[model samples]
Target: MQIGIIGAGGMAAYHAKGFTLAGAEVVGIADPNKPRSEAFAATHAIPATYRTLKEMKTQHPNLDAVSIVTPNKFHASLTIEALQMGLHVYCEKPPARNASEMQAMYDESKRAGKLLMFGFNNRMRPESRAIATYIEQGEVGRINSAQATWIRRAGIPGFGGWFTDKELAGGGPVIDLLHMIDLALYFMGYPEPNCVLASTFHDFMGNASFKGPWGIADGTGKMDVETACHAMVTFKSGQCLTIRNSWAEMNEREVVSTTFQGTKAGGKVERLFGIDGVDETSVDSAVLYTEEYGRQVNRTIITEKDETMGRIANAMNFVKCLMEGEKPANTPEEALILMRITDAIYKSSETGTCVML
Candidate 1:
């Protein structure tokens, strides 16, 4: 299994490491910035680098797949192009700018008879994997409602970069921190949503004090995206989901968590951070709330700590699905649905009314 990587940013390293760990050779890397691509390739021990995907493919004609780690604006176009070239694609998430783009990518993949998977990595977390098994075994029955949140006390990625520019990054934390939302939906069995009521606030849009510690290069682009978004989605099955996401808020600490209410039991998977994105300063836990012999009980579900937060594991799954016949952890269909819900959330926020799917 030979792979080509798109984008030479921080995430490309993770994909390179993951594919190599899964026994897939990363043959080449491509990025608009040649120096960055070369540096990344050299660091990862990749043999080649190119200025574009076309050039990479021309050089490595037998490349089996490509992992896209580009910005939100490039995900759909690149995925569609890669699939058209007869290569499987593993794209980083917020699937695309809108559902329409996601649908086009999905359609292209099907037309090309290739695989399309997104980086909804939360599904690969140890706690999430365990919770999924419990749900599958009927321990947590019929999830009725869920709340997904990724709130940071002062954790904006950058003050005025692509992340803060709505045109480039799609939206703020609602789209950027969508992992929790996807995780909640995955646990709910990916039900069809009926409608969404959402509101977005830009209170700290350009505040440098809220910048995150990741050190992504800051740009002088327009800082017009939201700082916080709150939304309620009701599903066709009558189940409900509430989403709360913010890069900057008046909170005590950074929290990434999802809690669900089920028929027989309830459960929560959470990570609390003293400083956002620093695993060493983070605490992880999973708990189940249920009754035994009519007595209320709580069970602490323990799992190994994953410092990478499943990012590498998610990439590995994509390779395994193609080379070892493993089922995909996430499908293009699920990604399209996630994007549709995301579109509705933004529309609802703009219209100040419920948006139907």
Candidate 2:
């Protein structure tokens, strides 16, 4: 598989490495910033760099796929364009700025008959994979409810940059840190949501004290996104999901977790970060709760720690799916559903009423 990278950002490097590791040739890299593209190409030993995907395609016509690591606003447009050009797409998360855009991307992918996968990396983690196996085996049967949270203490990224700008990055932590929500939905079989009731807060929106250590460049743009979002979603199947996400909030440490209650048992997969985005200071755990022999039982699941938190692995899966005909880890259909839920959350927050799906 010949791959081209769409952005010259930090995530583009990760995809380049993952594609290379998966035995795929990275033909070129593209970014509007020539210097950044050139730097990224040089670092990855890519043979070419272009200012746009069209230029990359014109130069490397044999490119089989492209990885999009650009901003949230570009996800739908780029994915649709790549699919229209007869190339598969591996897009970074949030799917798109809104559900309608996500739907358009999905429709185009289907019309183009090309694979369209999104970056839901949390589902690729070792512990998550293990828990999924247990779920499949009925260890955790018929998940009735779940709680998904990605809360941070003073961890807002680029306070005034695209990340905090509602138009650029969609919403704040609710969208940026939606991995847990997607993971929980995946665990619960992606039931159709009935409605959502959400509340968003902007208490620490422009506070520099909440800036994270990600080193993302700060922008002088409007910081209109929320600092925190809490919501509850009810599914038509009577299952429930509660979400809590925040870029900055009162918390002891950064907590990223998903807990599910099932008819047969219950389980949790979590990462406790001493410092946000610093893998060396993170601890991971997966545990299953059950009853055996009329006694309460708790079993800890042990798996190798993924310092990258499945980012690289998720990219590698995209490569394998294209090259080896393996099923993709995620699909655009799932992404559209996630995006619809996200849209409802934002709408509900704005209207102060339950938004029905």
Candidate 3:
């Protein structure tokens, strides 16, 4: 299927890189910024470029799928448009800002009779996929409890950029932290989450410690929503999980780890340790631990590949699902559940009470 990407952002670049690696043709990219769009096209050698998504759709009626990599606010609208245009969509995570929007996207896809895949790429990551296998293999007897973190140190995203503006961003670390939340939910077999307790803060919005290269414009930074986020979430299948995430931090690394503690086997599926690096040298090392004969056994680190391995793997997964007329692992419905949990966490933090699902 000919893929037309709908953004010129870094995530767009990642998908293009992956698709190219997977031997998929990226014929066009629709971006508002001509320079950014041209830059992306030049970098990826795309044959066609348009000023907007609608224009791209009009020009490329034969396009089969679109990869939506726009900001949080545009996900649903762009996805709905693509579905209406008779194109399957593979959108990035936190599929929509809230359940209402997500459900609407799902409904549109259902009516269109097309596939809508959420870009939960970690579903195709090596260690993440392996750990899920381990759990099913009874390496972890029964995952009763789990704890994960996406905390950052000195990690405030572009201080005055869209990331700090809740209107543009939807939320702070909550959305950024959702990769872990979704992964943990996937690890837990995606049981129905029963309730959520959460706490959010704007305390670090003005903290200069978080201002590294991205200097704040004024004494007060433009920070809406929670700077630091924490959530206590429960699932109906007797599974409970704790999540910690922050984009505003003092140090530079992304997060600590996802410590998988279950009834039997346990490990960490991290970008560094557990995550097998399929990209260049920087991403190959991962944090992984396995328990064997009562001994905590750390497994051998995964190797890195030179190609657009990770993203292409994800693209192939989506293509295979589309070819077989089946939903990919990261379907819109599954992504909606994750987004709902994310929304509930934010709501719970605001009310300072447990939110019922």
Candidate 4:
């Protein structure tokens, strides 16, 4: 497959490398930043580089697809455009600012008969998949509720300006650190969420002065987006999930994690306190501690895989679907549901009421 990247940022580089590892030729990369684009092209040994998607599409007419990793605000427009141009799209998550825009992109994908895959990387973690499978297999029996959190130790995106800006990021931890919702939904097989209520806070911006992997934010950083979001999501399955996402929290360690609360089997972070026995293998994502049969039992499953694993695995699945002429795992239509719930979270935060799906 001949792939072209829509953004030459760090994620685009990871996508390019992972694609290469997956035995696909990264034919080119397109970015508005000429210097960054040129540097990426040189580093990846990609023969083609362009300043715009229009030019890339014009140049590489044989390109099979485009992997978009631009900001959240640009995802919908770019995805629709790429789909209309007869290209399959594997776009980075937070697909749109709102559900309507996401639905439009999905509709266009249906019209174009192209695969549109959302990048929710948490789905690929080995432990997460294992436990989720176990839960489905009745290990968890009937699930009642779940609570997930992505907490950082005063770790606001002290990096690029795009993240803190509401216009560019669409929202804060609600959209950016949304893997918890996706993981919980995946474990629940994408249950129909009836209503969502959330409260968001921006109190930690004063402690946002720090170095970050994507670089640093300079000057007086005005965080116009939410730094924390605590939401309650209710489902028609009678399952309730509490979601906590925060980039700025005074905590001991960062949590890239989630949990599933069930009647038979409940799970939390697999191995929180250093690896030992089953506890160690579960790593950060999953932890199942069950006490039954007149005994205390603890079975840990470590999730060491990073977010990129899910993105790449989902992409590969999408590509296979394109080859087999079938629907993908993370389709644009399904992603619309996620986006709608996300919008409702923001609406609920603002209105101090539950936003129904």
Tens digits of per-residue lDDT for model 2 on 1-357?
899999988778779888999989999989999999998888889999899999999998888999998889899888988999999999988789999999999999989999899889999999999999999998888999999999988888886788988888988998999999999999999999999999999888778888898898888987998889999999999999999999899977899999999999999999998665688988999999999999999999999999888989999999999888887898887888899999999999999999999
Taking the candidates one at a time, how many backbone clashes does each contain?
A: 0, 0, 17, 6
TM-score, structure 1 vs. true: 0.99
Q: How well does candidate 4 score on lDDT at residue 236?
A: 86
List candidate 2 stretches off by more than 4 Å: none
Per-model TM against the reference: 0.99, 0.98, 0.88, 0.89
Pairs with steric clashes in candidate 4 = 270-286, 281-302, 282-301, 282-302, 282-303, 283-302
RMSD per candidate (Å) reads 0.8, 0.9, 3.8, 3.8
Write down the lDDT that model 3 would get: 0.74
lDDT of each: 0.92, 0.91, 0.74, 0.75
> What 10-residue stretch in candidate 2 is worst by lDDT?
273-282
User: How would you encode candidate 4's per-residue C-alpha lDDT over 1-357 as one tens digit per residue?
Assistant: 788999986567667765676667888889899888999899889998888888998988898899998878899899998998999898887888788888889899899987788777667656677786788688888778877777765566664477877888788888888887887777776778999999998876645442233354454434688888889999887888888888776565556667776778787643242211122333454568788788878786755555354556666665566555544666565687788889999999999999988
Off by over 4 Å in 3: 206-208, 212-222, 250-253, 272-309, 323-327
Candidate 2 displacement at residue 29 in angstroms: 0.6
lDDT of predicted model 1 = 0.92
